[model samples]
Target: MERLTGRLVQMYGNIVSFLRKCIFYILSVGLIPNHIAFIMDGNRRYTKRLNLMQGAGHKVGYSALMSMLKYCYELGVRYVTIYAFSIDNFKRSPEEVQSLMDLMLDKIEELLREESIVNRYGIRVYFSGNLKLLNEPVRLAAERVMLATAKNSKAVLSICVAYTSTNEIVHAVRESCEEKWDEITLLNSSGGYVPDESDHLIKVTDIEKHMYMAFAPDPDIIIRTSGETRLSNFLLWQSANCYLYSPSVLWPEIGFRQFLWAILNFQRIRFYFDRKRKQL
Candidate 1:
């Protein structure tokens, strides 16, 4: 009976995979999103609710992220972004902050391994944010992984660490001004030219060019778990018209069903978004 049960479980898994593939095929016919962003919320809450050991929830959350990444890539979503850490999270107790950094360093190093998702999916990994805020080890690991996979063109994965939308906007604007300062001040060969009013105005393109999330197009859907509808300063500038999906399940509890429903909703409302964009 034991042997029979094990075989049945394996068979059931195979059947599920086959069915999921069919559903994806049908989903592809109607609009498949090019970019999807995730605000991985409720990790601490999940741990507290379950009475799990300290830091266990994050480990489980990482596994859930891997699964979600697989589903997105398999469904032809070329760009995926996750809010891995926020700038405000630095206010946490020193011990907790360091613990999360340790976990980040470990997972980032794993991305460089041969069998990791970055390799498996031909993903170009990007660490998008004020990476300088991270500790030396974690920052270095992130840089290494980014450089190692910079050539992969099949898809893109952007991990936002030490990030917040307000900070990103401020940083972009600062960079934009500095980049154009020289031309604004010294347009003439003799260096005696007065700055034109137009030269002082920063264009939308200039700001966007300096944004951390510039590598991928604006996300079509931003999913925040644990039934949270708020963006929490994730991607304010880029999310002008994207759909916000709030699933009731916590981060670790999220799965294929929630993901599928989110896609279905996006497809259903895609027409309205398209029309709105045309009007804009």
Candidate 2:
């Protein structure tokens, strides 16, 4: 009887998993998100849980990202962005930081060599952070990947390495100021008056145009794994209207199920917003 009971429990678990998949599929068909961003948290935690080396955790996380990107593209998401490394990560132990830098360089090279993957998927890759901080090899690899996939329009994949939202804002401000100066000079040459700084404060839209992600639409859903709810200074401007989803799974352990759950939750919230807008 004990053996029978064990079998029954296993069967029940399978049945529940199947039901969840079906429900997720049905819900997703009705409401698809255009853009999804991931924080890709918990690589170190996953490595610790598995008793693996620190760098192994990052390798597993990279594999997970590859799988998840394919799933997102299959689900009809046109744009995806992932937070690979933050600016603060450079403050980690020297050894660990070196490992991460090497890993990034290796991954970028691998991606560049995978021309079949690019051609099959028509996916364009872009790096949306301060690339100046990266070592020459990694920087060149990133640039190659970006150039190689620049014409692909089926999907846009953005990786944020050495990125900080605050720094991004500061950079945008400086760029806007330079553009303003140029515009003012041009206007003056044309005998048109340019507004003084006191009279023309920078508007939100002007600042947005200077941002690295200015060409891309805002993400509709943002997912963070490892149960973290904080944005950790990521995409402050683009994420203003995004739906946040925090899953308990570590980055490597997160599979299609977690993705589905995030999409379903996003759909429900989107419906709510639609109704609210209609009422308004």
Candidate 3:
């Protein structure tokens, strides 16, 4: 009897795996986004719904995040970014803020342990934002994971912590100014070239290069959960023409089916977009 039950369980697992592969293959035939950004919202609300202790929502949301990352990678998505936390979030009550910080630190350290998702998928991890705003312990842990996974090229995971779209733009502008200054100084000293009006002007590309997310292409699709239709200050500069998907489910409640629907929606309009681009 025991042997029969074990065999049945194995067979059931095999069936589920086969179905997952089929889903990927079907989606692959259509447009597959190279990068996807997620606004992982409704964590606290989810916790409230479940009647769990405060901060438990974040833990559940973390599990959903890992599962979604794996799904995206299997579907040939090369880049995934999540709105992990915003600078505005610091205005919350002290206990809630501390809980979030502690949760982030714990998750970062967890990524470095054995059998971590980062190692499993060879995902390179990056944290974008003013990381100096983070406490020392959290910042150090983030750096450790980033350095540890730097060589993993299979996929990229960008977590926006201590971040907001306005803050990102400001940071980029500051860096671009410094870069332009260095160029001007080099031209005047080494090349004996005098500055002109054009030399002082900064191009759009200048600021783009200095942006923290310069390494990855802009997200092709941005998803928000919990029925939130607004961008909520995410990827403002990068998402000008990106497709947006907002589902009614909470982040922790989102499953593979929600992902499937988002991809199908993207596929539906990709052809129209491509033709329009050609005309342009």
Candidate 4:
């Protein structure tokens, strides 16, 4: 009886702690970030813990993503980006890679059918990455989503699949070089020496405009799940001034409450930066 009583007491304490965290989050909801990004990590770990199938963790994580998106939108965040799959993830087993690709295509198709909720809320969906690497079906699905949500102005949601920050930067640089070469050719036709693409000078600003996320503002807050402290090659250019948070919970375990806690922590960081800027 005493052991049972002690277990009950511990459970009660956990409940109280959770309640206090929720209250704190509620009080700071108004200070949520304008743009947020998430590294949805640890689906495999969660699945292992539950002794479930390999893909079951990703399925549960997808549900968590849906919930978090609604919560973030309700909290007034105008933009959210999630690192759904990285370029390095292609190194995983062929079966696992195929499963992820199939899942992504399925999710995009599902989102299209749920147009009522998405259109009503004015959410625009974009897929960012080296899209050429994706299969034709997945590519077409992504294109369809972009087209369907083209007119949405309320919120922007970006899914990064087969993406890497370094690759993005390199692509941007190559594009800038091409543009510069074109300009040099135009000038040389009138009199100046023509420059090769490799010889074309590139500026950071020029490369920035060519990046996939160039149309959106830099992320204000970045959240990584499953206790990972690293960025893992997410938006390198855009994360310069971003606040980062890592929660021990796996992506599948995250929900509205975890979203709220991240926002509250972001508010605290924003306050600190604001004060520092004023002093300077």
Worst 10 residues of 3 by lDDT: 271-280
Better candidate by lDDT, 2 or 3:
3
Candidate closer to the true structure by lDDT (higher is better), 1 or 4: 1
Model 3 ranges with Cα > 4 A deviation: 1-10, 189-200, 275-280
Per-residue lDDT of 117-187 in model 1, one digit per residue for the tens?
Answer: 88999999999999999999999999999999989999999999999999999999999999878666666
Q: After superposition, how far is residue 174 of candidate 3 from its true place, in Å?
A: 1.1
- Give Cα-based local distance difference scores for all models: 0.94, 0.86, 0.91, 0.85
List the RMSD of every prediction in angstroms: 1.6, 5.8, 2.2, 6.8
Candidate 2, run of 10 with poorest lDDT: 271-280
Write down the TM-score for model 2. Answer: 0.86
Give the count of colliding residue pairs in each prediction. Answer: 0, 0, 0, 0
Q: What is the lDDT of candidate 1?
A: 0.94
Model 4: per-residue Cα lDDT over 1-280, one tens digit each: 9999999999998896688557646765456678989999989999999999889999999989887786677657799999998999999999999999999989888887755446657899999999988889999999999999998899999999889999999999999989987887888888877556786377778999999888788888899999988999999988877788899999999876677777777777787756754674
| 3 or 4, greater by TM-score | 3
Which 10-residue window of candidate 4 scores lowest in summed lDDT? 20-29
> What TM-score, to 2 decimals, does candidate 3 have?
0.92
Clashing pairs in 2: none
Candidate 4 residue pairs that clash: none
Error of 3 at 153 (Å): 0.9
Indicate which candidate wins on lDDT.
Answer: 1
Candidate 4's TM-score reads: 0.84
